[model samples]
Target: MTGRHILVVDDEPDIRSLVQEILQDEGYSVATAEGGEAARKARRVRRPDLILLDIWMEDVDGITLLREWSENGGLPCPVVMISGHGTVETAVEATRLGAYDFIEKPISLAKLLLTVERAFESERLQRENVDLREHAQPIIEPQGKSPVMAQLREQAQKLAQHNSWVLISGEAGAGKGTFSRYIHDQSTRREGPFVEIAVGSMSAENSAAELFGAEDGETVNYGRLEQANGGTLCIGDIADMDLQTQARLLSVFQTHSFTRLGGSEDVEVDLRVIATTQRNLEDEVAAGRFRDDLFYHLNVVPLHIPPLRDHADDVHELLDYYIDNMVTHERLSYRHFTVAAQNRLRNYGWPGNIRELKNLVQRLLILGSGEEIEVAEVEQAISTQSVSGEPTAQIVPYDLPLREAREKFEHDYLLHQLMEVGGSVGKLAKRVGMERTHLYRKLRALGIDHKKGIE
Candidate 1:
């Protein structure tokens, strides 16, 4: 923390020396500039942590220099405008021109030190946000506008306004996954990577490989948590992560750092963790499957996303939105659902939620004839239950039978949980009945290695 760089911009040599001595005694690295051009050049070259600018310069006045810095948009350091002759109006102008704070000259050592510290802290936060943005991926788009859907959007937007950990709950088939994306998109950290992981998708053995990220064939790999640094990490399926894995994860969340399995040296990440699950976390915690402390931490901002069946009024808008997207993507003629078809869709229980709905619409657009989709077509589609209606294929009992069935089951279950949980293994293992270590062993045996889903 020592040797923090400070740039003192002042035409008066006496003032600059006094300030430099004071700051250097306080363990800061001080640089002096006599004029606006020199200050700008120093800023470009060294990019000091903070700048103390004298408002009454002989050539270009401090306020003028401040405005120039603002206009250029490359002012790397936070500027604290200092002056002996500056008035209230000058201070205000300096502030408006992007000065961090105004400091009156004949400066008190205490006041000046406090203001400088505040400026440095502000600069640090801004830099962290920039680094986070540079590493993050773009937010996924969310579309819809029915009253209920509108309310959900509003809720998601409100939640994104803060930096708290969010726990999104919804039954399977609900739009929790989509809502997670919407929240991240609306957040200030939107530019950061939205590294999503389904907690239940990887077995305890593979969970390490999947979430923390292990290298190929004993090489170095970046974990999901590390990759998501400075952005949002959406962990899906809170219920599947086993106790041991959850404990390890809890440690990471507590410390904000983690080391890959079979690796030395810890990696740090700053992220807004948004997790989703269909199962109840309280229930999982009570059942001794999830760590209670972890639950409390994750559940700080709980959001219950209503299932589509409960928000029937929003069905038509969703239908229209998906239809339009399909038409545009496929370069096909425009299409709309008939009134009767719309009614049938609304009445039907969408157990699979928004994803199921989107898939259905895409299927209809691909298979249906004519410009208008009819009630009969929708009825046929839903009745066939073509998407979620069918049960997942059961894994064949492997020949070894040495935990093969359980291993296969774990593999399939982990993948499903990962998909449903959105890449949160801690949540996933809690959902399934097993320890994370056991799950990992199964994952290794089954060979399940995947990355973020490509949208």
Candidate 2:
């Protein structure tokens, strides 16, 4: 894991030097600025994980600088205020302006270190809480009692001990993200952020800025690379990343450093990367769509997650898990799957894998009112879905907010319909009950390829 970067901004040269040395000794990357102008320049060069700003500065006072940062770009990171003679009003104002903590100078090294640690911890907790609320799903650790799942989990745990970039290959909805998160949670840097980015979902023009960050004068946007500095960065559908972004990522893997977009100074990052792809990356490289050099870099440790059909014995457990999860998280009524229903699902080929199973369970609970889900109900549902041209199993995140849930459903419905109709936009529009032009507009709005279907 990478050490946290700390910036010490003080008017007194001696104080700046002392703080820098102290933080560096404590396993933090330290940068120092003698005044506000220098501090602004330093921040423009690279975003710090934490900033220690002295209340009194030469050119610009710390309070003014703090307000500027908070107003302009929003404080990129936590800021701690330092003053020789701190007043109650100053402390209150600093706190109100989003200072993590206010410390009186003639500072104790122990107190300073403790405060910095607390600030980072608090930030991590806040981020986690927000993620939890947004997801609203239970944090399950890939539940299954089957030998295949057990072996996979064991292998992942062992691999997590090493600090190597990992490439996870699996079918779409095969739980690649779940396995990636499992590795991160079990790894040494579990406390650090687990940042994930879906490369294919981003446009080529914006991928660079999103991954490498962008700096425009006083405004700065920290990217996934910087956000995952001390932890794991999980890149989903990495094979779809544009060549330019792939080159930049490859450079970062080689040098462990990269400059942000529109920024001159290099920002160093230490992070374990876990990339996933549903497509054959080797084929992508062979076709000149993906960079071979980048493939070689990311393929240091490759792990494949088998489709649900390959692990039939785990189907029962997965069904039970999702049933319970939906009842608890989605506030759906409890319903037990019948023995025959379980047997049928176990024998069936689950093309969509775990994600498909999860969605199936949620759909059953939402649409079925009986206390028990019977084999007939399961068969009817499967048959209906198949006739509708949807996958045998499809994932719909019902736990998402209402607007997001509707969008998800619409995106999936249209994609599945388009695929079923062999990518004919006119047929799809008629099937979905939308005008052809409106369907085109909707496809474009949803970032789907009208003729090619979802990409």
Candidate 3:
């Protein structure tokens, strides 16, 4: 864990210096502002974890400044007010304006420290509560009693003890994000924020600003790196991150600091980075898509989460867990899976892993009325899903060369479409938006029996 940053805003140089020294001695990263204007500049430079504002100032009264901040950016951090001539009304007004606490000057050292500690604790709890309410299912470690899961969790726990960067490789829906959060929760910086950025979801135009933040005059937007200060930053689909952003991130990892977009000052950060990707990063590097240096840095503690097919026995435990969760949270009617149903699922391959299992449980609960889920229902559900083109149960070989993967997908898709069109080449070609002759030639090149599908 690292020290929290605190900003002290007061007109009295003596008081400001004294408080800064004291807070520094207490293991806080302190920034001092002589008055309100300076306070605004300090905040623009860096967001503080807490603030100590004096009521009286030469240019702007502390109360006015407090109200301004509350109205504009909603008080970015907790503020504790300091007043030389204190009154119940003044304290009441400050409290109403979102001040964490009020302290009368000639401040007692003991009271100041205690109040600061309480403010930090209160802020942490509030953030956690908000996070819980936002997420339907609060993040937790991957749940399973299977040997593979047990060993995965054990390895994660061991990795959590160190601050080295981690790279998690897994198939989609294999719970890479959940595993990252689990590591953060078990690590030394559990109290700090866990910021995750889905690199693939971000557009190239806004990627830089979103990852490194941007500074436009008085407005400052903190990026993922700044927001994740003193904690873990989990980057998802890191292989898809643009080359420019990758270079910038590489610099940050090397220097432990970064400059915001359009800003000159380098802002230092203390954070552990954990990157997750479904693609083979080594192939990405070899293909010149990902930086080799960055890949090496992140691959320090590599962990691969096996797909559901690898641990078929765990299907039973996962089914029960998701079923119970849906019943409790979604208020769906409870249903039990029969031994035959469970056995069938165990034998079936789960291409989407845990995510697929959860969805299956929820579907069975909503669509299935019986008190028990039988093998017949399971078979129907699986078969219907496959036939409906719900993505084949086979995991695509992401490590394959681009052209090979594309050809493979095209082959499977054309075959399915041909089967769906009932061996009619004209209908298949029309459905696939291709001329019948060209479609036939393509099928012949792909080694498909076009004669069977001819109109």
Best by lDDT: 3
True lDDT of residue 302, candidate 1: 90
Clashes of 1: 46
Clashes of each: 46, 0, 0
lDDT of 3 at 295: 96
Supply the TM-score for candidate 3. 0.79
Cα lDDT listed for each candidate: 0.72, 0.83, 0.84
Candidate order (TM-score): 2, 3, 1
Judge candidate 3 against the unseen true structure and give its global Cα lDDT, from 0 to 1.
0.84
Error of 1 at 359 (Å): 2.0
Per residue, candidate 1 scores C-alpha lDDT tens digits across 1-455 of 23466899999888889999999999888889998777765643343657898888877777877776676544546889888877878867777777888788788889989999888778667755763343222225555565776777888889999988889998776778777878887988775556678876787788876667543322345567765666788889977877777787787778877766665556555678888888888999898887899899888879887878887887887888767665654444566899998888888878777777866776576556798888888877776553464325475656757776776675666665554433445545666777878766655556765233111
List the lowest-lDDT window of 10 residues for candidate 3.
Answer: 384-393
Q: What is candidate 3's lDDT per residue for 1-455, written digit by digit as tens?
A: 36799999999999899899999999999999999899978877777889999998999889998897787657777999999997888888889989999888898989999999999999988888766544446648688888999999999999999999999999988889889999999999898888889988899989999989887775667788888888899999999999999999999888988889988888888899999999999999999999999999999899999988898878888899888877886567899999988999999888778777766676677667979999998877776454222425455599999998888788878876665443467768877999988998899878878545322
RMSD of 2: 8.7
Candidate 2 Cα errors over 4 Å, as ranges: 85-93, 108-110, 138-140, 384-455
Per-residue error for 273 in candidate 2, Å, reads 1.4
Q: Is candidate 1 or candidate 2 better by TM-score?
A: 2
Better model by TM-score: candidate 2 vs candidate 3 = 2
Residues 1-455 of candidate 2 have per-residue lDDT tens digits of 35788889998888888889989888899889888889988886666889999998779988888888888757889999999987888888888788999878798889999999999999988888866654445355877777888998998999899998999999887789999999999999898888989997799999999999988876678899988988999999998898989999999989999998888888878898999999899999999999999899778789999888898998898888877776776567899999999999999887667766776776677567879999999987677554222454356677889988787778877876665444568768767889998888888877778644555
